[model samples]
Target: MRIAFIADPLPSFKIHKDSTYAMMVEAAKRGHDLYFML
Candidate 1:
């Protein structure tokens, strides 16, 4: 399956540990194609 995420930019520090990043990471691990949009 493929998944995409669209979100406004997070604060710089927040990106490192943000939930969105985690979700993307997990999705990639599970073999889902991911895309990001502002």
Candidate 2:
């Protein structure tokens, strides 16, 4: 599946607390194609 995330800047995400980052990680584990947009 293809997943596009329209979110804040990538570098600004804190792995321990960012929900978007967590979702991205899960998507990656499932082998989805991910695109990040500012």
Candidate 3:
């Protein structure tokens, strides 16, 4: 499966500690593809 995360430019993507990052990592770990746009 594949997932895409589109976060707001200023506040949504806090880089290393953000939930979006976490979810992307988790998905990758489970063998899923992830795309992010900030």
lDDT of each: 0.79, 0.96, 0.78
lDDT of 3: 0.78
Q: What is the lDDT of residue 7 in candidate 3?
A: 80
Better of 2 and 3 by lDDT: 2
Q: lDDT of candidate 2?
A: 0.96
Candidate number achieving the greatest lDDT relative to the actual structure:
2
Off by over 4 Å in 2: none
Q: Give all candidate RMSDs, comma-separated.
A: 2.4, 0.5, 3.1
Q: For candidate 2, which ten residues in a row score worst on lDDT?
A: 8-17
Per-residue lDDT over 1-38 for candidate 2, one digit per residue giving the tens place of the 0 to 100 score: 99999999988888899999999999999999999999
Residue pairs of candidate 3 with colliding backbone atoms: none
lDDT of model 2 at position 31: 100
Against the hidden true structure, what lDDT does model 1 obtain? 0.79
lDDT of 1 at 37: 75
Candidate 3, run of 10 with poorest lDDT = 8-17
**How far off is residue 2 in model 3, in Å?**
0.9
Error of 1 at 14 (Å): 2.2
Across 1-38, the per-residue lDDT of candidate 3 in tens digits comes to: 97888887636567777887778778999999877676
